[model samples]
Target: MKNENRRTFVKKAGIGIVASLSLSDIPAVMTGSVPDRPEKQEVFFTTGFKAAEVTTDSVILWTRLCGQEKPNPVVHRRREAIFRHPIDFDEEMPVGSMDGGVKGIGGSVKVQLSGGGQILESEWHSADTENDFTVRIPFDRLKPATSYRVTWTAKLPGSDALHTAAGTFRTAPQFSSPDAVRLVTSTCQYFWSYDHDERGFRIYDSMRRLNPDFFVHTGDYVYYDKPGPLGTTIEKARHQWHAMDGWPSLVDFYKGVPVYMTKDDHDLLRDDVHPFSPAYGQLTFGDGLKLWRENAPIAGKPYRTFRWGRHLQIWLMEGREYRSSNQDKDSASKTIWGEEQKKWLLETVAGSDATFRLLFSPTPVVGPDRDRKTDNHANKAFETEGNWLREYLSAQENMFVVNGDRHWQYVSVDKKTGLTEFGSGPVSDAHAQGWDQEDVRPEHKFLRVKGGFLEIAVVPSDRSAAVIKFIHRDVDGNPVHEEAFSSS
Candidate 1:
């Protein structure tokens, strides 16, 4: 058994719908109304284990340990190391256990235990005292598309026996050029209504039917609604998230999609909230940063890229959050993709051989966020002005940009090169907003502010060209827009 004293593993961090025309185009509200969801009664952490961060070969597993309480609220405040683990498993394994044996498998601090092929050595580390009792383990050397069982235990101070739970997980398929792959991309799905069932969700349900390879969440997954009786300050925004239960309905939708997400203003704090937002220069930065990390799977580096087969490579950027000064409109020093991220993005794209290079920017990589009614830095610099990416786009013919934030969707073509930019937004907000719909230059191909997820079906062909069809849908699962683009 591992040392029960050194159990706290401290670090942390952390949808859509459709619609269409005709009978199916009718909104969910007007359709044969679905019954309201049942009220959530007691949530006593009845669920013991959860897992995430699944890769082709490895996954990060996590679970919680509870303390004594009719409700166990004390466990939520103290971050301590009162955890344990077994070295073996029995036939009747519980739902959330990782360790195998009942007692110390060997020594108190020095022991070897095996489960999923690799042996885990007991490393005494302090666990967080004030939070959910949890531990993260890297299941290494796991085979692709195979399932494995794991268990864990946490021995309370002075207790001889250990508390345990067990669960199983399967790794993603191997990555030697998949025979087939598809992706769905969109953003701005704010969630607070606990209904779990909604018109917005029907879109996600439909997308799942297509069974995409992997989904990309451009940003604005959670909207911290504000401007209430509470004071209008940055701290207020930070507190708003904790008050709103942090993660929203969008989070639940992604749980089933194996999604990759970036952050937008809503997820950060409010509409147009930036690093220099009133509270950012103060102490609220740490709290805000901590909360964002705790609730989302934002890349530590913020902007990163991933490749799929030889046809597509995705580059995602953190448009906001990290910045020194925003008032200096022309200051190149005022960063968007922070220095490191910018270099990595350029180098990755420059060296990539994929047929289509996709960049997922939270805000529009082309126009102003009309919803915010301001010249959002993301649009002005990253798209219109001479930013690093604006230049990079000119040199690559097969590259395209996808974004979310303005609560609208548009397919714009570069007047000069005929390059297209697609954008989606506010996947679940109450009302649809209008973009400069009338300002459709010959360069503008499509734009709509309807609520829905962008359905991206990517078909790889043996004949060099890959066909990607972009289908737009609304709340009731109706397809409203369809356009196809291909690259060789």
Candidate 2:
């Protein structure tokens, strides 16, 4: 892949320009560069692939197979048997280490979860053939909040095209406590630019340094459908997942951090394709969503809640998928969070006994401008949750909202309520555009469209009161903004 452009971007775009970083600055030590390698030989059916879309209790592992085109045009096919072997964290074996398993490749491939031993193997989907010849296995029912070792194998029909890939992931903790939860929050990755840069790597390394209990990728992991010609894919009208593979820097960074990822518009396919756009903003293909499922470490349930001891419980909502009415925005009934998710979030919040409740979103609930309101595709979790806060829990102060999408970082506290919102933009990929400070209400606390991450400390007190302090900083660890407050 051509990386000179990325190399140049990094050298020039330092400090906060998230998209400016180039691929050259990464240390050879960090990247583990290939030493004088020849062109890759073609391996059809199971040669091209990497593990992705990880979650706590479950994972949607995927891979691309190269073989005969779909609709084989023949009946009475000779199918091969395929099987998976799962091991506990104590098993330090590789995918190749496992022995005794079946295999086969039919354009698309997969296996579901059942009792401990591998048993759920169904006919693969035909539609999965066209895009990179990939298939997904949504492995649910695994132990929650625990680590697992997975091994996948596919044996070609009448040929030794045995294909396999191995990886590890920890299920979102099933149990929560004040002290066991460690979530690392960050956003705006701009993968391709980091295909060669180290800035993104540096931040991820720091996150690993903190050794967060779990990693939370707030949003914009990959800018879907980048506006220019350099990005967008014609066949799909959006962007492609292979773009992620090209980003060596990002892949390298994630290799170290066990990331639980979600997206704004970027990971979905494009920047912002609303109801008014041409052809429903390029229509999100199952293949694209499938790719995301393959890569990120998250639970399969689009929106689920996890308890972090008695001190905290986080309810992750699928804010974007069903935010608006299934129709274009013209309908009077259109909304950000559909009635179902909204109801669930409200009920979950009202019933929770945790000391702190957090709604982790991809976009800001209260922005100074009209960015999300216009994008039909933008998630409505924030707006919907904000409304719930106003109508249902007027004085609720234990809940905290955090989001990352814009290429900046800031904190704001509502005067009428103790609710505070912390916004962190492109972790390393700073953007040129910024939030209009003047547009914000006079009560807004801090706003800066700079690239950085937020460090939050929740300290418990004897009198049912808790102290929370947040410090926002740039990639180099310079504090740009800070705040502290007490909540009861």
Candidate 3:
């Protein structure tokens, strides 16, 4: 029940740095303060400049043609001093210009991949008014366990000169190799509530230092329903995506490490929008789906599993796409993961022989979530399937869940089923809320209601099959708690 130093530190050195430094070095605010992170130069790309859906031999390279050089801010006239909520835009809020929001310019881009003595360049692809000047190029048949740099050169409609931007990533090792890997997972970021104004969210800086092989966004990439103007239309929704992704910290982080992006309710539309749920103002559930797909550099379906070498097998779940209505009766027929997705999950997990298997869910699975919340597998609204999922997963060897949506950090072990879940709290300390520190439940093994992220590392063991470590850190990259499980 006590906090432990990072397991790697104890293994490598007799004594290691605790939280990097003392609290005296940090400035105090009403909620606390963002510590000084090691300075990483921000790489500027005006519009869609990130790589995602990374795999062994393929990656989705995404970019958009923005008219401006930097990310445009969301101009607001009111102060949200208390709770964060969604609201429509004012008449003065410019919806079509870069000064108020990102405006797309039709252009053509050529992408090139370089690394390990191999360089391949693609033909120029034109962006048009139809798709908002965003383009996605999927590169495949790549070499495994190799580093690659992707560079894109863009030519504006009338401009003769071409502008260029680049990003770096490493492919996953062969599935059968016993190679260790590390990844970071985070969620629940509000654009209006970023911790550092210039740096955006400090968690991105903290995560960049770890140099994880990959990043998993469990969802809520942007709040379509939360303020800086509620995303009630395509224009406002695009503004939400641009303003969030436009942050220097976020853009810089994605430029270095590739990510696996998933969608939850907030980013999807309003809270818990299902097949039958009503729209948020004029924004339909279908529009929400298109917005996510438009912004993300995704390939194939949202829910899929990936293997890192021989030891780690990670499953990224899609909660919203194929789900039953929340108002439905909690019977066998009423399901969170529709039949097809449920079948895929069971079949894939049972078929995989990896030493450690983890599922990245946008919402809690084995949670002590707030009683009033009933949107995820952890709630009583879905208790029938929740119990079944817990029992089924608990019986599997070296199985665990990492979830998002909750604004607090926690580690919970289901007493009856023995299944465990880790909650990666909000992306900023300012975004943390929901449960009280004194409201510790029976299932909670460790609880901290603050903004931060969870780090998962699969380190190969000499005596065991593999050792999976979950380390929780504050916004400043200081380890608050750590746990390790050695697989046989």
Q: Which ten residues in a row have the lowest lDDT in candidate 1?
A: 98-107
Residues 362-446 of candidate 2: C-alpha lDDT, one tens digit per residue: 7765444354455422234244345544434336556777777656666766555555677765555334145664555654678
Which whole-number lDDT from 0 to 100 does residue 178 have in model 1? 39
Candidate 2 residue 397 Cα shift, in angstroms, is 4.2
lDDT of each: 0.51, 0.50, 0.82
- For model 3, how does the per-residue alpha-carbon lDDT over 1-488 read when each residue is reduced to its tens digit? 23465765575573334355466643465226756785422222565477777778878888877777776654443345523432444534667643236666777888999987889888888876677677888888888888999898988656677778888999998888888899998999878767776787899999999999999998988887776667877778877787777788888898888888888988888888886778887888888888888887787778889888889889999898788888777888878888888899999998998899999999899998778877888888899989999999999999999998999899999989989999988998777888899988899999999989999999997523788999999998899989899996
Please name the candidate that would achieve the greatest TM-score relative to the true structure. Answer: 3
Best by lDDT: 3
TM-score of each: 0.65, 0.62, 0.87
| Candidate 1 lDDT by residue in tens digits, 294-332 | 545433566767666656677878877665444455555
For candidate 1, the per-residue lDDT at 67 reads: 37
Which parts of model 3 are misplaced by more than 4 Å?
1-44, 73-92, 97-100, 462-464
CA shift at 450, candidate 3, in angstroms? 0.4
